[model samples]
Target chain A: MASVYIPTPLRKFTNNTAKVEIQASNVDEVLSNLVSQFPDMKKHLYTSDGKIPSFINIFVDDEDIRNLQEGATDLSDRSVVSIVPAIAGGVDFSKEELARYNRHIIIPEFGMEAQRKLKASKVLVIGSGGLGSPMLLYLAAAGIGTIGIVDFDVVDDSNLQRQVLYGVKEVGTPKVESAKKRLTELNPHITIKTYNEMFTSANALDIVKEYDIVADGTDNFQTRYLVNDACVLLGKPNVYASIFQFEGQVSVFNYLDENGERGPNYRDLYAYPPPPGLVPSCAEGGVLGVLPGIIGSIQALEVIKVASGVGDVLSGRFFTFDALTFQTRTLNFRKNPNNPISGEKPTITGLIDYEEFCGLKAEKQVKEITADELHQWMIEGRDFQLIDVREPYEYDIVNIGAELIPLSDLPYETDKISKDKKVVVHCKMGGRSKKGIMELEAKFGFDNLYNLKGGVIEYVSNYDPEASIY
Target chain B: MPVSNVSPDCKEVRFEIASRDFLVAERLAEKDNLELTGIYHTHLIDSAYPSETDRMSAFPNFSYLIISLPNLRFSEMRFWRLNSNNQFEEEVFEILN
Candidate 1:
């Protein structure tokens, strides 16, 4: 009989005993001896492919049996074998977990080592809903070492469609607790840390720093921006995946490689925040139940790839999936010159009030109309004077029946223009119009000057498509 | 590294420098002989100067080409020919229609 020392986590596999004696010779024989006696321990120890589960490290005396002889390691009489789960309360495959992860262990490209890394990794999942549900479950099942979840919401009946982490019994319980219970049951070998509160800017940096990578499964913009800024400030890798009804976007941001070359952050792609209310949340628009499964799976893949240091990590690139057309598009975003991130570090030190930054909180200003409305006004012979504040080349292309007074030449044209008349200023795409408005208001002191929204792009839409005035 | 040989394909012969790039250039140069010359890489957002990292890391035995990306445009290309003294002399290469 060979005596095996079972660690704290794996002691449950050995009837909560620190040591168990089983009759066997080789490592395979030893496992078979234990399995025959316990019957229930087979699924806990061996993967579906008949190899040892990755999270459990077996050592003979002093040598890790994985590097020594694997499952084929021979055992002598009175030989000391240790079965220790790599993490404390970390992700461990129970017999059921081993069965569920059989397919992964069998794949040679991933095999045992990848699973071991998963078990040793500490991944903090930001939300326990939709995308977070699958992401957490898969990471747990994969045998990740420590899984920390930050969520304050309670499990709602509506969350059952996609949040596989919680179920009917967990309806009113807090999401973090419910998820913790389920994950612990799924694999008692994993350490499940739960924070029953929303992630805020004050705690974001500290919380994110503890884990190697943060999976942002958040649902709103405020949290998303806060998390992004915090990740950038703390220099943690943010594995970002967002879903909107039928579509999803995934990208990796803010982590340096071993060589000290900093990878791209979120601001490298999106320089500005999305206009509020323009982008609807998954709650309002509704997502296909299976969509999060696809996206969350990919997010898990990115986490594994990043943790393992094997595959090409998606940094500064967005992989977008469109369920409507069944097409996947990859948009490569290069580092923007005006990117709030400077030289591999974030330029925006702290999170700004994004609602204010996005003009969501700004009071409505003077009225504005579409190009079609302007055209209709012209057809009705309105008395307002139209002014073009575009560059010479832009004005040379197209102008909506306006007097050409380039922004640079605005001071020269100011004397000839009447401040009493209501002046409508426009440019190619409205950028120059804002500049013109500033110049006119601040420098020229023209109180009546108004900037056109969406500029000439709106104006050209009203013209006949067949006619070519050019 | 600077350009050792010059070949003209209406004023642009891809500049080749590094060992890997030289092998590629040599093979392409053999096939396209007279039309190909040296290769060039643009250093964008850096000074009109070469950095210490660039100078120390680069092979000094061969000539090198450095084009600042800040100055690069569709109409004009600025060429810096490095001398034996490690000093760069400017040569303007203009694209003619």
Candidate 2:
């Protein structure tokens, strides 16, 4: 009896036995036996023409049968024939597809061998939204061998204006599922693995381990910092692209530079999260429809360059495009003296909590109130002390009738605020309030504090129509 | 049949090893001139195993040093002396940890 190991996705066909033992000799016989035993397995494993589906790869023992006579590769009694459906995530390309990219193939810099490297490489794209759409498309078209898409979001109707991967029909489907279907149709030869889960700290390392490079198309600061940390920790090259309104920046960081030295990662560039409300997301700031597309395609080019080992990768250098002026500037950023990785030969071998490091995660609760809830509190005439911890200028501009103390002067102002009364601290966004809460609790020994989740911006948008928050 | 690829004089002088690596076993064999018999570069990447590119480029029948760069510094150094079947089996080294 030959043991056939079915992957998790194909378990439904095998009656949920991840491992199914069947009577056979040789690889062909083993598969045929499985098909004969479970006819449903055949449909998933093969096409109507009797060829193995491009999505699945057959391995006899630990060796890839493709290198060992493929499906006809021999199998012995008790041999393990593992049927692994190539995870459909990003982009897949083949050597034969080199002709399709002949213009790139002929460039003395990037030849067939370079293209072959691109075809054999695995890349993980971090988003499936505006930036991710074009990034995935170009990478697929260029024929990256294995592409993984890590996105937990589903397609939204509002996303259609910018996200190119999802169509009108895929409006309500999971982003990864729609991306997988569309990308496979775009380049039938590539293997794509879709993870419909968030790239959290727990799974970030494992998910990132399989790929040589990561393309970050994410928008939020939490995801950006998380991706940077994971890539640096895994020693994987990260091609980073960010879009805000009409401005776009693209760079490759945490990769081995020309001198075999790793350059500054995002942490080195921005030590901590920008004072929460200082940066507005694309959702709030509103991005130009084509901004991400332009930046993302360049990100794809950088990924291809990194994977193929051709041309100078954009490590330590950033290229910015101003859509308003139609001008591009390449800013050569050197490694900062204060960078943790500078002067020391450092390697990130494990995943760390980037959200915690950036103070974005809710590790400690400060005086917090949701915008809607805070509005409700206002309407009810609550007697709690609403201390606005944002800057004085911010308070001078417009505030919800709270006393302005500012985060920096909180130490001196802590003496005035009575510990007997509940101090409900608030910042423009929730991040500063979290820090402020920790400070007040640690110093003044204040037992009562709260952080306004989503902060004043959410407050004004949801409640006050005349107030300007940004 | 494979013959020796190291020379005698090369064995007397200590070969250049990075400060992060450890000294294991050394031999004197010959291909033409005095060539050091068993020497391999430390593994800069993880996985504690040789890469496909490594197999295609380096010595196949000699003792190789496998060092892991764990702390961004060289972590473990294991010596592997190849057997007659061209398979690398780890050889014990007496170096202090």
Instruction: Encode model 1's per-residue lDDT on A1-470: one tens digit a residue.
Output: 78876544344456766568878887778777888877867766888988887645677766777678787888889788766442211112334544566676557577545665676688889988988999988888777789899999999999999988888999999999999988888877779899998797667777888898888998887777777777877777889999988999999887677787667767677667788888888988899988998899899888878876667888867999999999999888766567674544446777676656666676435445567767777789877888888777766666666888887888777875678777787877677777767766777677887777788776675564542233
- Per-residue lDDT over A36-76 for candidate 2, one digit per residue giving the tens place of the 0 to 100 score: 88897786777899888765667777677778988777767
How far out, in Å, is residue A384 in model 2?
25
Best by TM-score: 2
Go through the candidates in order and give each one's DockQ.
Answer: 0.01, 0.02
Off by over 4 Å in 2: A1-103, A340-352, A359-470, B1-97
TM-score, chain A, candidate 2: 0.57
The alpha-carbon deviation from the true structure for residue A264 of candidate 1, after best TM-score superposition, in angstroms, is 1.5
